[model samples]
Target: MCGIVTAVASQDVVPVLIEGLRKLEYRGYDSAGLAVLNGGLRRVRSTGRVAELAEAAAEVHAPVGIAHTRWATHGAPSERNAHPHVSGGLAVVHNGIIENFESIRARLSAAGYVFESETDTEAIAHLIQSKLREAGSLFEAVRLATAELTGAYAIGVLHETEPECAVVARRGSPLLLGIGEHGVYAASDTAALLQVTRNIVYLEDGDIAELTREDVRITDSAGQPVERATHVSSLSADAVELGIYRHYMQKEIFEQPQALANTLEIIGGGGLPIPQLFGADGPAVLGGVRQVLILACGTSYHSGLVARYWLESIAGIPCTVEIASEYRYRSSVPDPATLVIAISQSGETADTLAALKHATLLGMTRTLAICNVPESAIVREAALRFITRAGPEIGVASTKAFTTQLAALAVLTLTLARMSGHIAEDVEARHLAGLRHLPVAVQKVLELEPQIEQWAQRFAMKHHALFLGRGRHWPIAMEGALKLKEISYIHAEAYAAGELKHGPLALVDEDMPVIAVAPADELLEKLKSNLQEVRARGGELYVFADAGSEIPETDGVHILHMPEHYGMLSPVLHVIPLQLLSYHAALVKGTDVDKPRNLAKSVTVE
Candidate 1:
């Protein structure tokens, strides 16, 4: 998940580049760098944060430049491996991986080009420079060079010879051109360009654009000229600002109620949701879908896992949830009647996109994308999509995105249940009522944050944690464990409550903390027994129980009551405390809560 921002403007763009990189810091990067075409190509890089890079480039100024915040796909996170990789007069900053860089590097090496870095982007710089010798212009050279490269990439290239313009290309990764009065800019996300301009042109895959101060020219993958529509972005710069919250993670954790409310606003009129809420052709798609194959990764995968229970039990549809990365590589039977639901917070997740394509290649035509970003690649590729209204989730550890996704999936479940004649009218109305009241319920759960923060004080001293849940809440436990491990840097694992004695109980001890999600569902007694297993093993227990489960507090047991149980939607409420726990624990541990180590938001590379 690298970030790119390139500008060819009338005024000095160094400050713009630095500010853009600051906006993209939430994507998670190890190093930052920029190359400007002044009289000559001037470059600066830092193996630190963007603020440090800004300090290093304080005196540097240029009208045309390319900048990057690198996430280190091809090499170690060092200044030498940072972006704005140069070859002769050309400099390149890239997002996404170049899969065939080894062969390109080998050929460039044989051609007397010396390599200074171990990055695939370095090979790209060399290849583009070599092409410039034969091609007439920088844009032509970039287009020709990209044709030979393999894998996903969005790259911005600047040549000192072509000081008036910058060339940008997009393949599998996202790249947009910002049209401003004084300049044209290219960036990986709109957040980076929002400060300078709201007018944006989202480039299609394999489209290349040449940006100058006053003009932008586009060429498609086939080398034919084309035009892409420019739309005014609705997102303001303040959406990314951390107002009163200490970190983006904390801010996002508290924004869940509003996010869910916005996502479910279509059905807020006290009526059953129609399938068309998903897309224009949702009725036909849902009518043909006899089974579901849900594909997703990370937090999105946990959402899909939770959906498996809902789809099967509520809609009476057989469902299978697969981790996107593994699903793409393996051969499996594809059913045309099965709806392939690809879930992602940022719609650009590489594995999920690849798996969606793989399923399509196998002849599964009924595909739906449950995502947050409307312009993301997965949404464009899927036949139908439900865009969650969780606006601009800047935190690397997703909170609002996860809850909004659950809200969307719940609506999908009810729609399918109504279509399949699996639900009575009264039952459907009750489910609809629960969804209508979801935001209020979530807000009440958020009210318990202070108590959860106290629990986090205890958890911060421990290095290992185990999360347990039963039935549908099992995936909620999994999500809870993931959040703890992601932000708090704790070794956490989740298990179905019944599976504790099978193997995981061996690791439970007095020093280890066990967190359990105990909603007052049918499995309350069984989950209570699982907590007893942990208590019997001298494992310190922290339980987030329902209001009336009556799981009494005793020695070695700490219980924080949720506002209410929420029936089938309990997973939505249960996950909030876990998110708060992770956030507070990370705060106590002095870790980066928004940008966790060795992880990035929107995983664009394999």
Candidate 2:
């Protein structure tokens, strides 16, 4: 993923673009560059963080600019690979990969276009310049240039001759217009443009935004300027502010209740019920008839795993979740009836977008997306959408968004069950009742702060940890381990209790804190047997358990009793302790929490 910011203003745009890049640094930090349209074309680029780029550009003065913080996709991270790739006085910062870059590069070479950086971004500037060679405006040239690319991209083009305008387009990456004082700003992350403008417009795929010093005119794929509505960005300055919180992970952990509540509000227990995958209704929605194939990267992939469970168990539909980076390069045969569900908080996740487009090319239509942000590239391709209400998760360890995704998916599960007739009256009533109680239960878990704070001491010295779960608790285990490793940077792994004998029993030493999810479900007896196995191995167990499950307190097993058994809701409660553990672990270790090293809040550049 990469970060892009384009600004056109009467006053200097260098400082504005620099600040935007700093805010959007999480998208990518491998390299950074800025190009400004002054009386002449002045460009600064470096193979480092945004700060390095700013340092390199310290003396340059420019009026309008386009900048990029790149996460390498087509080439290695080098000065030659940094963005603001220029050609014939045209500068551009691009997000997304051009699958046809090799072909385009060859064509341009034949056409005598000299290249500088070895990036897919360069070809666009060359092509735009070539188009401008004809009798077209800069916006027309950019439009023509972007149309030829055979892959996902959000590009911002600035020309020396056209100093007061920036032209941008998108296919499968996010791009936004930040309406500022007598000027316009554009960036891949709202964080970058937050200081410049709170009133923003998110650009859709195949949509073009021609930004001028005076105003921004946006248009559809067919060249008609459309009505540009303003989205008042709600991201609080404090939300992103680390403040007194030692790390973002800790801040986000405490924000879980509100985050989950926001997502619940979006899905709304009152919304139209979700339809089943398919059966008698002949697929009410196209996505219902289609097989469900999910694509995501990292933590979002974990969330997808939980979604698969909800979809199959609750909605009576089969589902598959795949890692995006691997799935993007595979030769696969997904059924034509399949629907691809692409999950990413930022919507600019490169590998996920590639996989989603690949599925579409293979004729797998009816895509549905569950994401947090509107106007992200992931939203454009989906036939149906559910925007997770988790606001601007800044932590690398993803506490709030993961919980909110579960909340949204759970609501969706109930909806699909209702639509497909799989939901019996008693079952539906019970599920709804359970869901209704979820918020209060989560609030209760939130109150266990004193207890959790005390428990954090156990992890301050541990180097390795294991998370255990059975059945649906399996995903919770995986999530727990992820939170620990992500923030604490501890070596952690999740294991299904049944797999203990298959392997992994060798590492269960006394020092290891084996966090287990032992809910008071039907699996309680089976899970109790598994915990016995861990006890036999001399493992120190930290269990978040229901009151029904007998607390095994022999030598090392200690239990943190939950409010009650939530059945499916247990996963939510089970997560609270894990979050606290990570928060405290990171706190003791003295690692940066809010902005974890090598991690950004949004992966907007792919």
Candidate 3:
């Protein structure tokens, strides 16, 4: 939920570390602070953004520095609770909750350790100072300080006594080292590190690193040297470039076509032209699994919800989608006959990692991940991982990841459907052919941006929106409504087309805009009847349908006839229009599309 950036350079490093933290600000933070080893020890902290903290440190220039952006876990977000806490000679910044902090604090207080802040991170700096005073080196002090600490944590320390090097460690939270030509940099996520260097060393659990300008060394608690491998981030340097779009969210909204296309190629590329990203193991597992359980949080959870519909409809298998935070709390049945699929964008979400761990502890037949980050904690746990190739999404409200996940899930659905005899040989071939065409279909929907812009104007004036669909498309409706409420700051609701009469009918009126996913399928007549119910009640409508669906020519209905159907994969293509609708509507209302109020990009807090 927070960002940590550190550097040991021959030149001033405070400015660079603070800039990297700004790039990671979209992850959400409440306060900022930095510790610099100048002529003497200097620390600046504030209950505001990185820029505010930088203003307070304008006079300090240090060659070695470490900074923190806090999300306020242990205490209220105040200057006192901000990170980069210091003892007499040791300064530390930390991520993740320290479960046993109070007990350790009580013990230290009796021994004459005085604390200046109410933060759990402050205790660690004092602990390190006490340990080093007792004849311990920097590494040994960190090891001893971490010995009694419980729960998830990642810590970075800079000592005034030893100003040449910075020490870092991770047990549960995420951290990576960016090895650059001039010096080294470290941060909580790949974004902060990518600005300086693409070659990164991902620190796994129980791993620690001691970084200096001359060399980078990593070791375990047992003192055995460990090899640090370099993995490129999921995004390229060009990915962050918004190009011609007005905002990051707008750029990602249009990039979905190429992103989904990239995902389909990666997932479907066995021996095909598109480079094979998923290994032989992915197809093998999908061909053999008897049962499946999916886990995720927030937007990823909604994707899982949509995936369940496709799995049951196309694969003819029973699938359950569970929220990651609650999955670990339940006693679930798992055996060698079951398959667990965990989805995450960052791959370091605490709840998702805990749930994935719980599933493995019960001995699931096989564990897998569909993640964007290749070296994330969840990906490390998966026996096999199918990476979603959607580039970096800087917008706090996700746009590309959601669509790419749907595209990947669609591939998984069809591949399993062929093996289970739910689809015939020729039908499977046809579906695979449609997967290849998904990119173009999504592009066609994106080209209708002007039409969506017009619709957004009408939607911007309304206070509420309703999304309706039937059968497999119900989840799409739910996801569509969620996108609007998430970023557009509009009251939106989704309901099954058949359930419109049960309760939602009361809300129907001329000012209310109802979005209907009316595809040209066997259920077309029933869906048309459902639209008539809305029309009879004087509700305005914006309908997305496959060509030849024979949409009713109602006066208030605005219909966008989509390209040809892609079978069960059609929903993936169909959702593009709804997302664009929400994006444009939010932009029209002058709301913050990238960082919506009260919503964090990564739900790392809970």
Candidate 4:
């Protein structure tokens, strides 16, 4: 993933570009660079953070400029490989990969064009420079270059000959235009342009945009003019603010209750879900569905795994979950009656979008999206959408987004149950009551943090961890293990409690810490025996037990009891302490909880 911010303004725009890049640091980057068409072209590149790039370009200022923070793809992170790659009269900053760059590079080389860095992007800059003379306009040159390239890209181009204009294009990657009274801006996401304007126009896949100080013009791929509607954004600047918490991850961990409340706000009216919760024909779609298929990645995939349990057990529907990246590339049978749901926090995940498109192209059109951003590509592409109100999760590891997604999926389950005539009025009322009281249940779970922190202190020194659960909580165990490895740098793995006897038991020892999610569900007795399996092998056990689970702390076994057990909703409640544990473990180990190494907030490129 990479970040871009370009502006055509009457005032000096270097500060604005730097600030935009600063706001996008959560997306993850290794190098930062910027180019401005002041007199000719002034550019600076750094292999460090955005602050280093700002310090390097302190003396350079211009009315028109483009900046980029790059997460490496084609080459190592270095100043030479940074963006705003310049050749001849053109400078360009690009996000996403140019898959056929090697062939293009060879052809350009035969034509006497030289490359500065070993990057797929430098070839694009050279190609644009080569076409500028033939295409007549900067926008036309970009369009021509795009025709020759393959794969995803969102690029911002600067021309030395045209000092007042900035040209940008998008294909398979996200790009947006910001309309402001003082200037116009383009970026990879709205976070970069939010400070200047609330009004935005999201570009289609093959759209090209030209920006100047006073106006912006957009054209489709065929060189015909197109009009795009601009909408005002509801995201306030304060949603991304870290007021009292040490890091964004910690802040989001505590904001779970509020986020869940916002996601379930419509159901707080005390009735079954309306058809509009999904779409105008939601009830009909639910009634006609023969099966459920979930497409997602990362934490969202785990959430889908959890939803499989709910959809199958509560709604009596057969469910399947697939990793988005692999699903698109594999040959699979498509059932038209299957409800295909795409889950993503950013709604711009490249793999998930591609998978959804692939499924739709195969005639499986009953699609739905569970997303957080209303303006994201997945939301626009799906036939129906449910937007979670977990606003602006800045952490690389997801917390609030995952919980809010579960809350939305719970509503989806109830909706399907009602549509299938499986639940009566009183049963539906009880489920709604349990959902409305989720915030309070999560609050009680948060009360176990001090005790979990004690467990985390002991876990901080361990090198390996095993997470165990049974039935519906198995996915929760996987999520807990993922959080620990993602933030604390611990080697962690999860298995269904029954699978321990097959092969995982060999890894259990005094040094290997075993964490168990033990709810008071029917499987509690079986899970207790599994914990004894670990305890017999001298593995220290840390169990998150419900109040009536009868699990107690002794010698090598440690227990933190919950005040109550929430049936079918225990995953949402139990995940809270696991999040707290991961945060505290990362804190004790002195690791960066927000920007974990080798990870980005959104995986926008494949």
Per-residue lDDT of model 4, residues 131-173, tens digit only: 9889999999998988898999999999999999999999988
Question: Residue 2 in model 4: shift from native, Å?
Answer: 0.9
Off by over 4 Å in 2: 46-61, 74-80, 106-116, 135-137, 217-239, 266-283, 286-295, 311-319, 322-341, 350-367, 424-427, 449-463, 511-513, 594-606
TM-score per candidate: 0.99, 0.85, 0.92, 0.98
RMSD of 1: 0.9
Provide the global lDDT of candidate 1 against the true structure.
Answer: 0.93
Q: What is the lDDT of candidate 3?
A: 0.82
Candidate 4 lDDT: 0.91
Query: What overall lDDT goes with each candidate model?
Result: 0.93, 0.77, 0.82, 0.91
Which whole-number lDDT from 0 to 100 does residue 458 have in model 2?
68
Ranking by TM-score: 1, 4, 3, 2
The predicted structure with the larger TM-score, 1 or 4, is 1
Highest TM-score scorer: 1
Model 3 residue pairs with clashes? none
